[model samples]
Structure formats: C-alpha cells, structure tokens
Target: MDAKELIRALNARDEAAGPDLLARTKATGPLEIRGELLYAPLVRNWYELTDSLELIPAKAPEWRPLQCGIDERAQAATGYLLALAEADVFSGVVRLSRGEEILFEEVYGWADQDRRRPNLPGTPFNVGSMNKMMTSACVGRLMEQGDVRLDDKVIRHLPGFRPDITARITVRQLLTHTSGMGDFFGPKFFAGGRHRLETIDDHLDLIRDDELLFEPGARFEYSNSGFVVLGAIIEARSGCSYADYVREHVFEPAGMRSSDFPAFHELDGQAIGYTNFTAHGAVTGPRRPHEDTLPRRGSAPGGGYCSAEDLARFGAALMRDTLIGPDVKAALLGLRSDSGSGRPGGVPYAHGFQVESEHGVLSYGHGGGGPGISAFMDVFPDQGLTLVALSNYDDGARQIRRELRRIFWPAA
Candidate 1:
C-alpha cells in the first residue's frame, strides 16, 4: 500500500489490539521509499511521527556520500534542519555551535499563533525541567562557599522536614533524584492553584506531610519535590530567593541575558505556549493557547524561559567555569545515577545533565518538557560542540534533536 493507504489501514485497526500487536507489526519492516525508511510509533491512541531511522541495506542508489568532516556535517545539518522546519516537524529556535563559533542557526514556526508572530532566533521558550541545572549551580556555589555539604541531611536546612521520613535524605540524594520524595504536581497542586505555590516555601505543605516513595538512596526515581526542598536549602543557606539566587549566580555569570522565570501571563518576546485542548472544548491543532496550564511563576525545580542562544551561553559558561568552580562544576556534571537504562535513547543521567554515549564519544546535556513546551540542550565537550533547541509545542523538540544528532554523529 502507499503511505496514505497504509496510514488509513493502521488507523482503522481495533484499538483493543494494543501496542504489543502494533510493535510486532512494526518489527516486520517499515515502508521504504527512495532509500528512506518510515516508522511511526504509537502515541496514546494513534500512531505519531517519530525519528527511528535504521539503515538496513548496505547501499542505496539515492543515498549521498556521508559528510563526516565538521564543515561538511554543519552544512548537511543546516539543510536537514531547514527541511524539517519546512515539513512542519520542527518549530522554534535551534543553534549548533563548536567552541566559540556557531556552525548553524535557524528559527521556525510562530511565537503567537493568533498574532502570526514568527518565532525569531531570540524567542524565549519555557524550558520546563531544565531549570534544575540552574538550581544545581546554585547549590554548587553554596558548597564552594562552605555553606552546605552534599552529605548533609535535608533536615539540617529545612527544620520543618519530617524527622522520620526526610531526616535520612541527604542533599546529594536530592541532587541525584535518589531522595525518594514524590512529586508535588498531584491533586493538592491543582486544588491549591498555581499562583499560591509561587515560592519554594509555598510548596512545603504539599511535600511536608507526604511519605517517601522509597528509602533514601535506594534507587533512582525522579522527584520534583526533592528539588523543591533543595531550593529551600538554597534559600536557607544563601539568604536569597530561588529565582533571585539563580539569576544573580547562574544566569548573570553565564551571560544568559535573555533568561528568566517570569510570571505565567508575561509574554515579552517569549512564545505563547500552545496545546491541543482547553477547558472550553476541543480546540484545533496548534492553536489552543495554554494560558491556564502554567504556573503563576516558575520555581526551583523547573519552569524557566530562555532562548536557544541563551541556553548555548549557559553551556559555554559551565564549560568555562564561569558560574561555579572547577571542582563544583565537575561534581554537578558527574554521573551520579544510571537513570537512563530503559530510557528511549539510552542516555544516562548525570547530576544535572543527561549523559549520552554515541559510538565511543560522550556528550552531556539536559531536556525539559511540560504542558506546552519541550526543550533540549547538549554539549559535546570532547568535540567542542553544543546544540540547543527550544520549542513552544509539547512534542516538538525531541524528534528534531534526534534528526540533528544523526546528522552530526551518523556512526551512532
């Protein structure tokens, strides 16, 4: 069958057949056209577009020679990224840099779908969980000043912490997401309203009474509440609010002039976050505004606005030891857990960065996602390459990153 017919057939299949049958069918072979393979993964109830290219044949007549050199690869990457943008697969800003030189940069899609404001190269996008890196840097600075220690108990900083539950949880555990604390985004969060939970202390009631998911340091479990507690620690030790501390210590030092944790309604050159639905009813694709889906303001664990260029600047600063000392930076970027074992891309988890091994080379970065935003930033220190992608749509950044990685590191 042709592509359209194949999609129709796939869509007509019984939903009760489930992912197992779909996986089995996909394993048979993807449809091939002009040397390219097409495989769509199941998303929720339907097949969604994904990047899963696998070269089965030794050679294809339509294939071009591999551009392995840096300049050649950069050109190929730019062309590929433009094509993806043209095809509506990628949206927002992307930048790839080597050392101090930017190899490629492009912007796509709309910042405000209603106003038709095109997403400029400097458009700030909400980087959901990526703010954890900034929080980590604040902790690192506090550690450098002899204000805190990794092994120090959580109760040492937050006196209100439960003696029985959080007493054994250390700062290190919080940083590495091994503290066993559960997330704060539960029934209470929605009930309490986002505006009320504006500060680190504001989230304490949500977490203070809750029990741990497991014993501290037992395993790797992502805990947004753990980072909230860390933010409290930063405030208690540094005598500054989480946002203020990060701005002064992290963003300012990193030369990230365009990054901030603004209130939800603030839209100053930042993209208007969009999703597929609103409370009114089912909205059309890419047009539904996510105004009620965001917090009044961002906090320590996540929810910060930054441009792609600002993210690249943050990476460069981390590498140059501008934000934290060398020892602190090393600890912050060090591999602290094997959290990526079963992850989609097999990328390991570092202190605040995601570590990925491509062929024999390693790269460090982080990705963030939420209601209507997705973001990714990577720094290949060995090759002096840094990549940053920020999108206004929830599912836009991942596939773009995948395709760009293939362009730069084809062997992997």
Candidate 2:
C-alpha cells in the first residue's frame, strides 16, 4: 500500500505498533502527523497480516544494480537521478564512472543534524553489509596467494569449529551465505547468556547446536554468522587477524587510504551515530552504549567504514585489473549460485560481490548498512557506470538506491 495507508493499517490494527502517535520520525527529524486516514492499497494482492509494532527500527537492505544499456534514454534517466539526489529530499552520495572520466559525483544531507554538519563527498561512514564485500575481497587475496581455496572445508581452518559445522560447510558456502549457519547477532546470541563476547572466537560459545537454516548449499539465506565463520577461516589460514589481512592486502592494494576495518584504536573523522527517542517527544540524540547501539571494533562479519570517494576509487581500480587478475576477478563477479528463478546460470551470487540480473543487463557490487549509516556501490560493467550511495541516517539509503535504479532501469 501507499506509505500513508500502510501506516494507517499498522496504527489501527495494532495501537501498540504506533505506541504514541509520532513515536519516531524519518531523517528529516520529528514528523508532524496530519490526522491519519486509511484508503486503497498501493498494489493489488498485497495485504497486511500482523502488526506487532515493536520499535525494532532497522536500516534497509541494499538493492543490486541491474545493468542498463547506455543509450540516449539511459543517459537522460541518469541525469534525472543526479537531479533527484541533489534535491536532498533523500540523503545520499552517488558516483558514476565511464572509462577514465568521472561522470557524476555528489553528496547530500546533514552529517550531524544539531551541529549542521553536512555530509561532504569525502565524509566517512560505516558501510555495514558492504563490509562483506571487503571481507570477501580479503578472502580472494588469500586465495590468490594459495592460502585458501573455495572448496576448502571451513572446519579445517577453525581448529575447534562447532561439531555441527566442522564436517558440513565449505568456504564457498559461507561466502555465498548457503552454509546454514545461524545469524550471529540474532536471538541465539541475544537470548542466550553469551552475548557479551567481542571477538569472532567469542561467538563460538553460541554455536553449540549448530543448526542449519537449510541443507548446506541448498538455498541462499543471508547469515551474518556465515561471514563470521569466513572471518575465522581468514584468521586460521592466513595466520593473521581478519582486519590486518584485509589492510595489508585488499585496502593497500586498492589504494583506499580513507577506508579501514573498525579497529580498537581511535579513528579520525568517524561520523557519530544517532537513534530516535520518542519517550520525551521524539528526541533524536547520540546512540547509547548498549550492545545494539555501540559498534564492536573487531566485528569482521560487518561494520567496516569508508568514504564515498574511496569506494568509487576502489571500483575504478577493480575494473582496470589493478587489484586482482582479470580472469580471477571475473570469476569473483560471475554467478556462483542460483538464488532465484531464472535462466540455468542466471540468478547471481559471486565470490565476494553480488551479481545483478536485469533482462540481459548485468552489474556487480555490494551495499552495507549499520546503526548510524548505510551505503551501496554497484559497478555497471557494460555501461562503465559505478553508482555509489552512502547516508548518515539509518533506513533511507535503500530508498535512495531504489529510486536511482528506477531512474536508470525502469524495467528493473
């Protein structure tokens, strides 16, 4: 349904969902509710069933970029997206690359609302899930060095990997999120008495049951635990911590000076995080020090931060074959899993990146979101366009990406 109607349904069907009217607002700050009303649905056959209404606010998931043909129509569409991002109705940053020329670069929104700090082009922010791509890149470098193989069993590296996983999962499975490992930050850790562990090894205590979401490699299920296990593999095989391996190989090789894995030392120019507090009439302030609010430094499963420009530079370097061998990099971007209904080899999931399918068009990249920020970077190979968007606010980054895709590839 439309944003309003769906909101009304949620409010009426379950008062607990709304709690107090205008519980929290969007990136624009406290919203003014103009008397709620319910009406027709935005799409047919879509219905709301449950409205638990817990304030479990979350950032949006990243959308893949479907390659678009570079023609007159596509160019006009791309221009329109540039204009929309400039309006600042949505906080975002995007970069479009065509060969050696930089076609589009822009930033919008308040980095810090109260201090009036704008999110400049070079501003650094946490690229939550986007870190997974970097994590995969770290693994790729190790593979290039013959330190690990895609077919290697994860347990072979993890000295005392949970018994349930030691004999069942593969490196490729973990990279593709098909290992059936439970989500590392979910209920198993939240509910069990072992949520305080900070390192990847600290998470093993909750892996005792080692339940698979599905048979290994049977289906694609996004699991943070899969990445955590992958991190362990990197540590065990490389004889280096995940952060160090990535810094020495991926980041340094790509010349991404502004990017880094979250470390225990002080970081310069790190964007502060924020969350809304409706208890005192929608007070937006710095995130508290709870497990959910404070970011853990050693989190290899996610939470690497970077600037928009650095990400674009990395994409350009990757396309030029300066980072990894052309053939090996291509295989890393090629389809390695069938995640949906499509041609025999279609639905995409590459080694450490995401493959996009839009009719005959294809693109590869990854997006990341965390408590205080969200980011996405997709490289359109044929079009030579690399689109990067990062936001300081929580959930709005995905919407900006959706609108960008709609502008560039309407059919997608």
Please report how far candidate 2 places residue 118 from its true position, in Å: 2.5
Instruction: List RMSD in Å for every model shown.
Output: 6.2, 6.8
Please give, for residues 71-133, the per-residue lDDT of candidate 2 as tens digits: 543465456544444543345566555544656566666666657677787777777788777
For candidate 1, lDDT tens digit of each residue in 349-369?
656667777666677778888
Best-fitting candidate, scored by lDDT = 1
Off by over 4 Å in 2: 1-89, 188-198, 203-210, 263-265, 276-291, 336-347, 408-412
What range of 10 consecutive residues in model 1 has the weakest lDDT sum?
Answer: 41-50
- The lDDT for every candidate, in the order shown, is 0.72, 0.61
Give me the candidate number with maximum TM-score. Answer: 1
Clashing pairs in 1: none
Q: After superposition, how far is residue 382 of candidate 1 from its true place, in Å?
A: 1.9
